[model samples]
Target: MIEILNPTSLPQARETGALVADILQTMRSRSAVGTNLLDIDRWAKAMIAEAGAQSCYVDYAPSFGRGPFGHYICTAVNDAVLHGRPHDYALGDGDLLTLDLAVSKGGVAADAAISFIVGDFTPPESVALISATERALSAGIAAAGPGARIGDISHAIGTVLSEAGYRINTEFGGHGIGSTMHQDPHVSNTGRPGRGYKLRPGLLLALEPWVMADTDELVTDADGWTLRSATGCRTAHSEHTIAITEDGAEILTVAGRAQP
Candidate 1:
């Protein structure tokens, strides 16, 4: 469902966004070589509980994924890109990890994701992948605002990835997110501007730009949740939740902000 949050509800959205951001930042700070993915999941669980917020993923049972995500956060590593279910594996040096998180608090929701290299071994390819996604995310955000169409955002994101020589996957992209985690008005990583849904005030959108180093194909992991690159090439994803306003778009999920 598409949800246009009211002005009063904006505070709750911001609060939820801040909480998600803090949890992600805390997790990122704590994650390192030898850190277990399951441990990260446990940390997410504890933080969410402490904040008195609900996890949007734990009970997520969608047609595409295995019923009930059964985890606190998504932990994608190296070749993995999306819906990465936390496992028992420990992180290694030079591992590219993507952490995607969403939470609900005060009856509102916000979602965001970040990709970074673990440990001191940062491969040039991995760094490039992460940088491309981040730049595309910024472009997407810059294209967003009241009166802007969803396609405009998509085009902006696509230009960056394509110019970076990465292949774009349209299957899973950004979407409208509010009281619920995923909603209508699917936003693709690449598209034609001046098409698709028009932006309006009070609308919340989670624009994510993800790409694979080589091929655009994806292969599902045995776990039934993690999505990986078909060629086993490294992948990266970056996301942010923004609220459309009269002046422009207000980013809701930037990390390192003082909690409200």
Candidate 2:
């Protein structure tokens, strides 16, 4: 379904987006070496409940994943990339972790994701990978505007990642997200501009560009949810929920100067 929201509804979407951003910021701040993955899930659950919002993932039982995610947040550590289910494991220094979150408030929804190193150990390559995704995400957002086609956004993002020498994976990419978490207009990380769905005001899109260090292949974990690189190469993911406006695109998820 392609769900669109008027100006008033857009505020609610921003609230949802803010909630997601705040929670991710909080989790990232509290996370460190020896922090347990399950503990992070617990923190997310508490925060989501406190916000009086609903989690789009807990009851998510799509064909691509095991029924009913039954978790508050996705924790993809190191090799893990997408749909990372929480488990009993402690974070280690230099571990690359990706946290993806989505929530609905006032009947509107927003989704976003971030990747970071666990502790003081920041690997240069991992830092570069994460930086590339963020750059691609920014480029995609800049390309999104009223009357612009979705392919334009995709192409903008793809140009950044490809030039960085990372392989793009299209099996799972961005999509239309509004009343529901996932909707129509699957936005690939790489695509030809001037093709696909045309953008319009009131349309909300989640543009995520993720990549594996050495290959585009992926493997599912035994838990049936976490997606990892086939070659066990480190990975990174960056995402944001954007609203197309009459003038341009508005990014719903972003942190203040104090946030890192």
Candidate 3:
């Protein structure tokens, strides 16, 4: 179920991407030492509805996760990495928070994620973990372009994580996004270049690089969701939805300014 989007479809994707980015940004801003996770979920829901966009997470029933996620967004804190179900917990200073969001707008879907420290006291390890994922994400995006193989992107992403002394996990990585949140052409975080699917123009891919501080293994929380590091080490994740174009890849989920 690979989806390709032409130039026109890119705008709708930008809208979806912008909504995701803005929501994450807003949530991060509003989040405080005592802010409850449920409040964050509520904020996300309000923004999604206000944008007239549909949440890819709510009512999601993926096999790996508990049926019908029933959440507006993924609120991963500290050890929690992916599929974090919001619970009754208040954020604390220096807590590592990750927000992953996906939304469908005008029939196109865009997904993105961001990790940041909650308050002050940014631990060096936490900052390093977040920086490593961001660096890997940048490398992966840079390797993406027309005529490049999916392996190229994977290799670029893996190199950064490996160089930073982090183990690679292939169970989950980037994937195609359009018309729906997740699609075909699975992009692993580590692979050989010049192999796997050959990328081309009009293809949309969500490139995410995530890593745990010490282990490649993951444990699921009692809730049947919320993947966490096996050793309880800190974690970080970075992601963005990108569209392949004639000259190169266009990142639809950039936060600040538009790239030329």
Candidate 4:
């Protein structure tokens, strides 16, 4: 379902977005070599509870995933890209980790994701992959505004990824997000411009641009949740939730570090 927040609820949306961004940033700081993925999940759980917020992931039973995600955050490592279920594994040096989080506070929800390298080892390829996704995400956000079409955002994102020589996957991309986590008006990573739903004020969208280094194919891990590259190539994903406004687009899920 597509949901547009009322002006009054927009404040709550900003609050929830800040909370989500802060939590993800804290988790990223705590993540390092030898840090267990389960520990990260536990940290997220504690933080969500402390903030009186609800996790949009844990207990989530979507058709694409096994029932009840049972994790506070998604810990996608190196080859893994989306829906990565937290496990007993510990992060290794130079491991590319993607943390995707969504939470509801004051009846409004925001979703965001970040990809970064763990420890002191940053491979050139990994750095490039992460940069490409971030650039694509920025492009998508720049293309979003009141009266703009969804395809315009998708096309901008696709242009960035394609130019960076990464393959785009449309099976799982960004979407409308509001009171609930995932909503309608599916936003693919790549699409033709001047097509699809026109943007309007109060509409919230989570624009994510993710890509695999080599192929567009994906293979699910044994856990039935984690989606990895079919060729086991490294992947990167970047996302943020934004609210369309009269002036343009207001980014709700800006990273805490980037905020004043």
Candidate 5:
């Protein structure tokens, strides 16, 4: 279902977006070597509860995943890319970690993700992967605005990843988000321009650009949720929720940036 927020609800959407961004930033700061993935989930749960917000993930039962995610946040490590279920594994030095989070507050929801190194050992390859995803995400956001098509955003994102020598995966990508975490108008990481749904004011979209270092194929882990690179190569993901407006796309989930 695609949802467009009313002007009155836009404030609530901004609040929800800020909450999600703040929580993700806090989690990233707390994450380090020896920090268990489960601990990160616990921190997210506590923060969400304290904010009087609802987790979009914990009880999520989507057809693509096992029923009831049962985790507050997704912790994708190293080769893991999407739907990363929190586990007992502790982060090691230089581990590339991705945290994806979504929450609802005041009847509005926003989703975002960030990828960063766990400790002081930042491998050059991991740094490059993370930078590529971030750049792709920026490109996608730049392509979004009223009258723009979803494919334009996807093409901009794909261009960055492809130029950076990373393989793109379309199985899971961005989507319209509002009262719910996932909605219609699926936004692939790569697509032809001038196609797909046209952007409109009051519409919220979660634009995520993720890539694997070597291959586009994915393999699910034994947990039945975590999606890893088929070749076990490292991966990175970057995302943000933005609201389309008359002027342009206003990114809602920004860590230290001003909200439009």
Candidate 6:
């Protein structure tokens, strides 16, 4: 379903967005070498409850994923990209970690994701992968505004990844988000401009750009949730939720420099 937030709803949405951003930043600070994935999940659950908010992933049961994700957040590491279910593994130095989170507060929801290196060690490939996604995400946000087309956003995002020498994957991309975690208007990473849904004020969209180092193909882990690169190459993902306004898009799930 496509949801357009009313002016009154925008406040709640902002609060929810701030909550998601805070949780992600807190998790990033706590995560370190030897930190268990399950511990990260526990921290997410506790934070959500403390904020009096609800986790969108905990009960998320999509056809592509195993029913009832049963986790508060997605903890993707190294080769893992999307829908990464927390496991018993401990993080190691130089591991690329991605944290995707969605939360609801006051009946409004916001979603966001961030990919970062675990410790002081930053592999050039991993850093490049993460940088490409972040740049692409910013480009997508810049292309979004009133009277804009979804294709414009897609084209901007795709151009960045393609120029970075990464193959594009159409299987999953950004989507309209509000009231719930996922919604209509599937925003592909790459597309033609001046096509698809037209942007309007009050519309919320989660723009994510993710890529694998070598292959565009993905393989599901035995856990039935984590999606990894087909060639076991390193991966990175960057996302932010933005609201279309009169002048331009305002990033709701703002983190660091994830601003338009």
TM-score for each of the candidates = 0.98, 0.97, 0.97, 0.97, 0.97, 0.97
Question: Which stretches in model 2 have alpha-carbon errors above 4 Å?
Answer: 256-260
Tens-digit lDDT track of model 2 for 1-260: 78778888876777788888898999999899999999999999998888888899999999999789999899999888899999999999999999999988789888999999988899998999999999999999999998888889999999999999998988999999989999998999999999989898999999999998999999999888999999999999999999999999998876542112
Candidate 6: tens digits of C-alpha lDDT, residues 43-68 = 99998999899999988999999789
Q: Single out the weakest 10-residue window by summed lDDT for candidate 5.
A: 251-260
Clashing pairs in 2: none
Query: In model 6, which regions exceed 4 Å deviation?
Result: 255-260
What would you estimate as the lDDT of candidate 2?
0.91
TM-score leader? 1
Considering only N, C-alpha and C atoms within 3 Å, which residue pairs clash in candidate 1? none
List CA RMSD, all candidates: 1.0, 2.3, 2.1, 1.8, 1.9, 2.6
lDDT of 1 by residue, 109-198 (tens): 899999999999989999999999999999999999999999999999999999999878899999999889999989999999999999
Could you tell me which residue pairs clash in candidate 4? none
**C-alpha lDDT score of every prediction, in listed order:** 0.93, 0.91, 0.90, 0.92, 0.93, 0.94
Encode model 4's per-residue lDDT on 163-256: one tens digit a residue.
Answer: 9998788999999998889999899999999999999999999999999999999999888899999999999999999999988999998655
| Candidate 5's TM-score | 0.97
Instruction: Give Cα distance to truth, residue 33, candidate 1, Å.
Output: 0.7
Question: Which candidate number maximizes lDDT?
Answer: 6
lDDT winner, 4 or 6: 6
**Cα lDDT over the full model 1:** 0.93
Positional deviation of residue 94's Cα in model 5 after best superposition, in angstroms:
0.5
Task: Please give the range of 10 consecutive residues that has the lowest summed lDDT in model 4.
Answer: 251-260
TM-score of 4: 0.97
Q: Kindly report which residue stretches of model 5 are placed more than 4 angstroms away from their true locations once superposed.
A: 256-260
75: Cα error in model 5, Å: 0.4
